[model samples]
Target: MAQADVEVVEDMNVEGGPEAGEAVQVLRRVFGYEAFRGSQQEIIEHVIGGGDAVVLMPTGGGKSLCYQIPALVRGGVGVVVSPLIALMQDQVDALRALGVRAGFLNSTQDIEERRLVEAEFLAGELDLLYLAPERLRVEQTLSLLDRGKISLFAIDEAHCVAQWGHDFRPDYLALSMLHERWPEVPRIALTATATEATHTEITTRLRMAEARHFVASFDRPNIQYRIAAKNEPKRQLLELLREEHAGDAGIIYCLSRASVEKTAQFLVENGIAAVPYHAGLDPRTRAEHQARFLREDGLVVVATIAFGMGIDKPDVRFVAHLDLPKSVEGYYQETGRAGRDGQPSTAWLAYGLQDVVQQRKLIDGSEGDDAHRRRLSAHLDAMLALCETVECRRVRLLAYFGQESGACGNCDTCLAPPQTWDATVPAQKLLSTVVRLQRERGQKFGAGQIIDILLGKKTAKVIQFDHDALSVFGIGADLREAEWRGVVRQLLAQGLLAVEGDYGTLVLTEASGGVLRGDRQVPMRREPEKAARAARAKAKRAPVDLPEEALPVFEALRDWRGRTAKEQGVPAYVIFHDATLREIAVLRPASLDGLGGINGVGENKLAKYGQPILEVLAGRGTTDGGDAAGAGSGSDHAPPEPPDDIEEPPDDIDW
Candidate 1:
């Protein structure tokens, strides 16, 4: 045979699979994408050619396509190991909608359901099969895999293999057996959030050290970063909701279950459709609320960290942290859930001195080795630095993930820059107050108490302790109360002050001596003026500039989408994302071909909902979608007691 014919024969005979270029064909035909993004094509080819790989892409960066496409081109079933059981069905359902034979087996399945899937697996009928890591430990599961061709292994959320990861799963440690048992099979591990340390841990633990690593940029520029000094957090959050994100879907993350309930109740009372999610709720309640949040539009979920791991909703307009996230990676992953469709979103946080104290105390009281405590402390320090940063927030955030970028003008600092002051003198006074209260008066106090003494406020505690007699008392009267609080917080962040005992009493650290002697200088960011903040909020809340005629069309399309999703028992975004709806509304696509041309309106979706959507746009359809639009809230308020695992400290101390 000629050289070309020989090559074709080799391609056709290789495991009786599609040709080498079949991966791209699968991408366009099955997934409905025109092309590969970033290193997707390269990753797919490497895995299909039977090479080990590791991928670290940001959330919403198309990580799934890396492995999903390879599964289609290669022979046999592609086994995906996922950590979240709640997310497995959604993943499988989405794949099925794309015309791929996909299935999942977990505790949620009945014995008959599992037996059917097992039979299919043995018959070589599945293109993609998702399994929770714990399933791999079953002898039947291992035996079933042994009976098949076993194309390749895809480990989703591979960062869980790292013990220090935000969502670590012990069962993920068992996944190393994939490499050990199926030595010749190609393996691909992927995560949306991983630091350099976590990256190393994933490789080491998964035994994929030799895998080719594909790292993508961690920056999500469409999501604006904003952090404010929490003052009356509930009211401030209400103001944020009213002024900026009115009638939008979003999430408010609290630190504890009680806080979740209270915040949810507060929002409901204020006329917002809100619900709470945490481990404390009954499992059925959590599942029901999750279903509602996913299937409905304009819903706000006030929840703890338990709420967002496998959330695939793309229209979350904002993620507000009422409590500082435990680590920068956790914050990145949580905020990444917003604007998954690349629309403008916000990552808003309300941070205060009490957050620092509470987080520190949690770390201190945690049951761990010294090394573990130090690691936790290091993570907290990074989180605090991100909040205290005066420069671009994106710059600091991306740098933590080993990528460098210029100032992103979308962040709060870049937009409404704060004034920095030479706070050396103020730092000295704050440190001196801590030292005097400790050494001279033998009275330890928190930031609030220390600030009262500094500003010459003779509260009952100061009068009782005779703190009014101290030399440092009233010396800080020149600065306002908020400024003094800022100094104390900066001092704590700088390691010049430490909280000791259960009361979170402030005590001077060894570093405090340098500042007291004028040998150290502290630069503090002055809080943005109230008027400047109001201006920025107003600017952000400016009405969308859609064409006059498009407004009604957009609303009608949303209504249609909502109804269709409710009837189908799926999320509205599953039918068509808000961005896709907006495109259709603006373009006013008149035919199936026109609708198919719009992004996110794939072949399958167009074939299914095309006519109804057209009718809705044409204003002849009396059919209903669901109510697809709603409003926002913010703040870092105190939550109820956290479950034992969440590490909330006692609230008796006056932080």
Candidate 2:
């Protein structure tokens, strides 16, 4: 068949059948699971029913079953090509324990062992044969799969196919060979993380452009989102570990191998069961360390970035980053490793100005593209904005990804919204510090030196340059060093500060110039600690805390949406969507004014869901109490605004 024809058939709508019914029966019998979720049945039908598809599901959302159950029904030795040896072995072993024939091929297998496995695969004795992607190009391997005509190709961690991805691999490049060699067979590329750009890249790169695309919804209600300033991070972490994550599986991320070791030791000293994992350790030691983390329950793994990518464990309750990740995608992909069981989880990070300089240095100092560097730095800046966002964490994150989210009560910012104050003067002072430091040292200083000089702290460098005597010295005496750090951080987040390593200095951006000139409205927000604490406590409540009147309606809406999605073989939100649901709840239009009563609902969506939405919100259970509030009074947790005289900007847009 032509590629376009294959595309048509791959996307052609097909409903459930007797075979699928039998598959469901067997699913309950062997796996002891009730039924399939999301598009698992359709995904399996596409793959096992002899077609192509790509599945995007969150971790612990049963991605494995999409391939596992289909492999059994396909009636051939299902050849699974994956990248990680540990993940491959875990899947293969689990299958074997279920009384099904399964095996794996990797460097771990000796020559004699390879011979035995190869012989079984050829003799049709194995139902599933898992091998590393790097090994798929070998002569003996491809020859056998070509001779036997292996079952569907399941590509786990399919996001790695995109060069723009965080975990891209070179060997994954050869995966297009599957399309060439197995043109008649189906292919399924699955990944947990792929934004719009990466999503498009996967289809183009994997040669799956002609295959079915299943994008599951991105909402993870169970995961509590958080971003905190780097205020006594060590002590803060200890308290969080003891309180919220007590006796739960978690991951604590640091930037370096030494930091991993030290932090792990510190946690151990404080009575948390933890161990370090990093590339610095010997191969044997790394293996043992990873094995222990997987085997033992609730054991925390403190490590650098190397410890990720291969982990498949579920029920990880928390993921904390002691330092900032390089990009928002890196942050999302890493933090996503937690709360995989669809249970309550936390995504927390402690960051500050130093994190900014380090990340910029790493990016500018790397061999990657200048454009990629710029984009990465911009993305990090956006994340820093999220850290300082007083609006809502979930809303900000969703906005960055080109989606809109209602206030998520589960995030720190939503529980106790940061109280805003006019900091136009402090901001002007800070911007002036940059101006003075740049001019004084012949434009040869960074934020750290400027901060020191501002706080009246004289050092050898300050004495050498006589910066202590500068007129700007002690001008910022009103604020402590920590508060000054907060100001600098907010400036960086706002694009008022830029650190280019080549300059080895802090250069004020146009935004800073405006702030200094008193021509912008500078809204300053303090660190949100109490909001985060309330979010932690409020999580004990159920998901989607709409008021009591809105429950049945939301539930009914979700059910109808779920059914529509399965029938179309698309994600739930894509059909009849979230915007449609929200308009229904908020406006309470008694009749189909065609969504005219709703603010966001336009003519197009109104034509599609105006009636359905009207039906749901009208028969309400409760209004969304909205996000977490002060538990006692449920008062607007927006922090009390600081004094008005703090600062005021000139009354016009400077830009």
TM-score of each: 0.89, 0.77
Q: What lDDT would each prediction earn against the true structure?
A: 0.75, 0.66
Question: Can you write out model 1's per-residue Cα lDDT over 1-655, one digit (the tens) per residue?
Answer: 0111111111121221234388766754654445566677789899999999999987767777777777878889899988777766666766666567888888889999999998898898998888888889999899889998778899988988989878888889999999888898899998889999999999999988899999989988788888989888877777777766666778899998889899999988998889888877777877777777766556788888877764666667778999999999999988987766565787889999889898889998988899999999999999999999888999999999999999988787887777889999988888888878777867788889889988999999889888889998899899999878778787788788888879898888888888889888888888786633853564466446344445556667777777776676655555665556666766776788877766555677778788988887766221233222220112111111100000010011111
How do the residues 1-655 of candidate 2 rate in per-residue lDDT, one tens digit apiece?
0111111111213244445576665454444333555677778777877888888765445566777777778877777777677555555544553456788888887999988888888888888888878888787778878767477788877887888677777778889989898787788888877778888888988888888888766666667888777878888888788877777777888998888899999999999999887777777777666766654446788877766653544446788999988666677777877754344688888888888777777777877788888777777777677777888777776676556779877788878778887877878877787777677556658777788888888888888888887888877888888888887777777777777776446778877778777788788788655876686677545353244343345445666665654564332323332333443544345666634544323344456556766555544433343421222232222211110000001111010
Model 2 earns a TM-score of: 0.77
Q: Ten residues in a row with the worst lDDT in model 2?
A: 643-652
Clashes of 1: 10
Error of 2 at 596 (Å): 52
lDDT of 2 at 645: 8
